[model samples]
Target: MQVSSWRKAAITASFLTLAASTANAAAGPLDPTQGGAGGRIIRVTTLAKDGPGSLKEAVEAKGPRVVVFEVGGNIDLGRDVLTIAEPYLTIAGQTAPSPGITIIRGGIDLKGHDVILSHIRVMTGADGKPHFSDWEADAFSSVAAHHVLVEHCSFLWALDENMSASGPRFTGKTLAEWRANTSHDVVFRDNLAAEGLAFSSHPKGEHSKGSLIHDNATNITFYRNVFAHNVERSPLVKGGAQVLMVNNLIYDPGHRAVHYNLMNLEWTGHPYVTGEITAVGNVMRGGNSTDADLPFLTIGGDGDLKYYGQDNRAVDRFGKALPMFGRYGETKARILQQKAPLRSVTGIPVLPSGEVETSVLQTAGARPWDRAPDDIRVLFFVAEGRGEIIDDEHQVGNGYPKAAETRASFNPAAWNLDTMTPRSGRYPGDQTGPQEKLSPRDAAMRQGGV
Candidate 1:
């Protein structure tokens, strides 16, 4: 087959190229994304930060392609961020060997839409930066993106917000234009965002945030995920955002958990647009370093947040009940007791809050069946009701794992290329049976060949 270019139209948002895809993408009007379904397979043969056979190259490749990892272990990014600006890209991180691919000292930044990021691990350390330096990075984020699905990935030790959906609020003029341009139709489901680095790298002191759904970012769903040990912003929605948060476990938020804040200064001349948040069947448990009397959802300045909730649970370390809603800013910033329009738009099923902790720990994060040490440590901490906000990543989990690097060839016959799932219902190093029921510590020890 001849190679083809991934074209982008000047006017149309998603219509880019015409390639002979297995299942044609960009064939019709914008629909829900099927990441790189029709594209050719691009094997990542090296764990180098960038180069012909590296993960960076696969993401930055011109045409639609499914990026599969043959190599596993850490790829030290050396404090750099790999921005995937192309559309129709599928990063098949589950294809890697045991321990899976872990990106260290950096992050994956998304700008283009029509992307699926799954089964990946990104651990962003402080990188030897001073406490109040200007440096910042998200383990995974949509800087300005849409039509994306991020699932079953692990994001931790971020210098700033661990994950975010953000973009230029006003690319054109008027409300419709703002909504069209900003990040929308983005979903973070069955993933993990934990241990955002406090008091490190970011210029502002104490910047351990989870997800920042920026102004005007609409149709955002955070479902069945885990947010732990982050000081704040276990997803803070800004002005004009539409969001659905369901069945997520939030632990050890220092002064905040799930919050809605529309800072006035950030809006400046723009008209204040109301944001709506539907938080249902979510669990928030206070842990060490959690602020006294922390609310599950805190409403802040400038804009009123239309809110609705059902069966949400918030408790202290001792299992004492906590308030579901609180206000920190203006008396005008109201939490309207009404169901958000987004609640009806999304179809994410909600589990009871009581089951969230167990469900998240079992399935959240990259390669959950073969967790790396840091993931095990974080999940273990959450399970034991122990953990704290940290200024640096090395404060936990013996830092990064010291596993010897491993690699293998791409055996096309073993995987379903369209879905990037193994044909045998098992990944490269998946160990089922008794190991499936092992404790996190035992799993870690076993993973280390001890």
Candidate 2:
């Protein structure tokens, strides 16, 4: 068929537009003296003693510009860099992508609007003194801030002293204490977190709310991110509230992987509210003793299991079911294959016959748990590989089929000592398998194996 005139014209227009846009971005930094230039670029370096202040001043003076923190070498946060003063600024790390600008002493207290923190690391207080204590509130606390985007970053090591009071108190109780402050429209995507060190605390009432936490913040999506060696008294979310917890690798040194009160949609006395919480496509592992009352997923009270979905799953570093909750909605979740032979969570390979293998392992690594749980179920996609399901009682080979062909369902009631056999299928043989079983590690691996 002959090409039409409209097609030719459209192709020409698209090429010209792309060329013009490329030219504009490549024009280098704008002249400071020029008016109406709009966007300006600011750089931060550790070479100078006055690096943080100088960079902050430049950002404030530039007015509505992108402030790029360019580190000459790897630098740790001496004190808190970029305090609560500068708001509405897009901050990005340059020397390296994530774990580049490590916040050792203090967190980036976000109280402003439209703040974007990308490719940075928010670490715990590196005081050089090892103690069993949690960090003060949040490493990056956004108190009443709006429209904040935290992408490609890492939040690790928020340990509290074991002797500290259990349960939620108020400010400064523990790192979890900081989450009590309300913040809205916060997006945490493509980030990694580990609960470093060891501390103990208890779960309290309703805390942080209104946030969209996912892995696919950018165009290229990943499977799961790993979080190991973290300890906590109780679960992250309490009471009935809406939060997006997906594609994450969570491990526990002492406490359960996840603990939350299930919202009872039918009960009048229960404070259960209809919330939209999606726990899909994540890998949870770790914790000692398989039969430690660790529900691969647990929800407290008579709450509802509203959309509790887990597919293509794996155990923690210790081979225990990654703990989870929210049974308000009884919709059966998709369980994927765990032994898909191939590595790599995202980017499954295409075969010579034009077939794509989707059973690739997204996350693979050592067990985070000091002791592995007794009953653990690992779900894998058929395209990745075929394997047997093992529990306390027996082992079943080729139990569930791969997502590329068939659908797998999880029965919490029937998930005892019986191993389920995986259904056989075809998968691409080229892609590598997941590097780590934990979500955070798997997530980091996908992004060039951190």
Q: Pick the candidate with the highest TM-score.
A: 1
What is the Cα-based TM-score of model 1? Answer: 0.88
Off by over 4 Å in 1: 1-31, 339-341, 345-347, 433-450
- The reply for model 2, stretches above 4 Å from the true place, is 1-38, 47-62, 74-82, 95-99, 126-137, 160-181, 200-224, 232-235, 262-274, 287-293, 301-305, 310-450
- Lowest summed lDDT across 10 adjacent residues in model 1 is found at 2-11
lDDT of 2 by residue, 1-450 (tens): 332232232234332221111101222121011111234555564423244534445445535555544342223444444454445566544222222344444445556656555445544433443232233334454554545655445554332211011122123343233333334445444344433333221122111111112111111122233344344322243433334444554443234444444333423443333223445455544444223434445444443434345352445444444444323234332222223322222322111111111111121111111001110122231222222211211122231111121112222232110111011110111112322234687678778779
Clash list (residue pairs), candidate 1: none
Task: Give a tens-digit lDDT track for model 1, residues 1-450.
Answer: 211121111012221221111121223222357888878899998889998889988998887888888788889898899999999988888888877898988998899989988888888888779977867988888976989988878899898789899888777789888988989999887788999998887987888999999999998988778999998998899998999887789999998998998888888988899999988888999999898889999998878888888889999998999998898865588888884444663433445677667656766777755777777778888888988989886786467667678988879898667666666655667644312346678878988956
Assess candidate 2 and give its TM-score to the true structure.
0.48
Model 2 — which ten-residue stretch has the worst lDDT? 366-375
Report every candidate's CA lDDT.
Answer: 0.80, 0.34
Highest-scoring model, lDDT: 1
The clash count of every prediction, one per candidate, is 0, 79
